[model samples]
Target: MRQLSELDASFLYLESANAPMHIGSIYLFDASERETPLAFSTFVSYLRSRLHVVPVFRQRLKEIPLRMGHPYWIDDPDFSIERHLAYVSLGENSREASLMTLASKILEEPLKRDRPLWHITFVDGFQLGGDKEGNPGFALIVKLHHAAIDAFSGAEIMGKLLEYTPKPQPISAPRPWQPRPKPSEERVMLQAGANILRTPWRVTSIAAGAVEATARGLIQKQLRRIPLSFPLFTAPHSPFNRQITANRQIVSAKLDLSRLKAIKATLGDVTLNDVVLGLCAETLRRYLGDQNASNDESLVAMTPLSVRSSTLNRTTGNQMSAMLLDLATNEQNPAKRIRRIHWNAVASEPYREAIAADRLTELLPSAMLALSARLYSELQIAQRYQPVFNLPITNIPGPQVPLYLQGARLVQQYNAAPLFDSMGLVIVAVSYQGSLTLNFTMCPDVVAKGNSLRNHAYASLDAIEQAASMLDPEDMHTPLEETRSQSMADSAMNLLEGSLKKLTSRLRR
Candidate 1:
């Protein structure tokens, strides 16, 4: 059995009642042709067949005999698809409110580890008002432990589960279940003996690595320590950042990627990610300004960076480091902020040294590695010594083409990420098809009027779009047709006032 990766273990350990530490997606599907009884059985049978091939699908933790091993399907296990999937009907309410309520329910408690590593809730019977052309749709919420898959691999797994064609022939035959023999007491003792044999060399290597890390930390103390002193604009202590209850609120916005792409084209090679961050920064700025709690200090965001190689794409667990970015909200111009963000991201360096140190520790004996990890986590050297960012931003890329689930055409998608105690706000962006849907999950107490954040986000995008359009020197002088008319009206009033003053002077003479 393969051991749990360090990234996966970290997620498992960091989980608490307030934060479940699971990544989930909400997919809206247009109504499709109904499946026959035989077809439905075929679908379930296909899933069962797939599960046999994928070891992770059926595996539950074997914590007692073995600490953690590759998941093996539980034989004759209790499997209830109905319990995992739920159907709800809202009474005379907006879809957004219904979705928010559903999100709150999902985050109410962490998943039980006695069963599978993941669960899905297929929500049908949604009654959203729309034009005749718009068809009725249902939502599928898929929640999986972070240890089970990274964002990229998760998308791949989703692709595998869906079909490209409208209707396909069903596969025949379920594989016979054959449980592998559990390791005996003697085998366990033999494993322990092997670990003991390697302990000395492992200790020596770890000690040397620690020395090197210490030296590097000393040399780069200034850069590493800056995050600590960086003042947070919304540093107002709120219940959100304090100990949290087992409740969560999720809000999402479907943004047009084509608009973002248009802006990027005008701005010259700026990434869609930069545009997203810029919008978030502007939104925060406006929200704080509205509350009269605006600060001149730059807002910082913690962006997770994936460290996995192409070869490790299917590997589960978190292989992530963070980069603290200055949102530059103090700047009034949106274009300047976008440019600054792009440059800052480009200039930032990856934590290669720290990753190397982590890799070195992995080479040590299991016991020693576990001990070192525990010490590091308990100390929280990264959080304490490093500057505390205001929020966490995650970007998960999804399938470019339309995806279908159970014959329904998948439309919109939203991602829900965890919010740490210190970082009250977590912004997640998932690109599905041609749209970049942004989801914000935050502490309600800290961010009062969370819905307003969506409005500000739209305004920020508008500002950026306007700025990008003004890239042409001629366009800049013309003041844009939308603004030009307003400016002319104001100028005309000023000219009339000057003429009136002269006429009054002549009359007085």
Candidate 2:
């Protein structure tokens, strides 16, 4: 049996009814490409044939006696592909909004612990609504527990499951399945006891490493004379950091990837990620402005970073870190916000705290890690702290080439990441083919205005696109566009300043 790493196991302990720890993606397939319409049975057969490609699909978690340790993955003797796959019909309504709502409903509950932590729901009879009305297409809703894979690993697994060619290639014959016998409770208990004994030295090593890294970070910060970004708990309380509930609402919008690339090209020194964050900043700015909330303070976003090496690309489990960066939502200029975000991301990489946290996870025993997480959850420590970050912004790079399931051509793909304690919003951006899809998962209890946020996301994209179009390569504005663009910027800044002044006055009183 292979034991779960602390980072993987923490997802288990962090899970509660109010916060389900799983992330998933939705894949839309255009069935018109196929000579015959793609059926659910055909998709199931495809998944079954490729089941051996990813071992995690057949493995189930086994707990130690008395919960003394983290769970282990063992091949399930009774594993059935049918158990993990199901079919859902959209019925009368097959609009994109309806599909998102159905997807949210499907993911409302936590995955069953008794089975493999991944489930697939094949949605049939969805209308793409092209030149032909009721042109039947289909969608595949894939949900995988966080313990099984991070976004990077999950993307790799997706590539493994799909094909580069529409013509189905014959899969290799599977080797005979030999199930390993389950370990006895006494053996597991004894093993847990031994692991507990070694915890101190392991923890000591981790602490030393963290201290060294932190010291290096501090020295780097001092030499650069750049103040560290806003610390956790410093983020002003917003609707995003309230008590969360299980009820969730999900929505998505797509941005032209070429336009994003053009923005990066036009803004010479900016990266695609910088452009993405700039859009998110504007989205939050508009969203907060609508709520009559203050945008004077910058909001912090916990951005996930991939730690996987090229050699370990095929390996599963979590090998990720996170960085906290100020979103600069208060900045009214789109161009300036993008540049600042780029610089902040570059400066903050050297001081990433998530690496130290990951190191601690690597050294600490599972039981100890789980215990600490349990305490943090049960005691509601998040409420006491201001908030480590306002929300999580994750960007997963997907295949630029088209992926196919049997003969159906994959069209649009969107993804949603699970929300953690007090984190009401998680923005997952995934680029497929030439489109970047922004999927938002919000806890209804905290972010009651989910639909509004979704609309603002699209609006922000439009604003950024407009801003990028107006700027010349030299950052000089043509006489014709300069006046109009400047007017727009000035108008926004005036309103923002007025709002900030009022907020300051209210706080002073």
Candidate topping TM-score: 2
Q: Indicate the TM-score of model 2.
A: 0.83
Which regions in candidate 1 have their CA more than 4 angstroms from the true location? 32-46, 52-54, 64-96, 128-134, 168-177, 184-193, 196-242, 312-315, 351-387, 471-509
**Alpha-carbon runs more than 4 Å astray in model 2:** 130-132, 169-175, 200-232, 349-357, 360-368, 466-509
Q: Candidate 2 — worst ten consecutive residues by lDDT sum?
A: 478-487
69-101 per-residue lDDT for model 2 (tens digits) = 678998898898888888988863476666878
What is the Cα-based lDDT of residue 369 in candidate 1?
Answer: 39
TM of each candidate vs. truth: 0.73, 0.83
Estimate, for each residue in 1-509, the C-alpha lDDT of model 1 and write its tens digit. Answer: 44465456555656667668777776666654545312334445566655554456655554423322222233324544444444454432336457657866776568777765777665655544454333556666778777677665666677777767555446656566655555555765555446436443433334434464564455357544565342222223322234344557777777888888887767664687888888777877887888776557666666776767878635455566555566777778787677776755654432222122124233433333344444443444334543244677878777788776556667777777765545557888888789887898876755678888888888878888887776664533332112111222223334434554564354334
Which numbered prediction scores highest in lDDT against the true structure?
2
- Candidates in order have lDDT scores of 0.59, 0.74
Model 1, global lDDT:
0.59
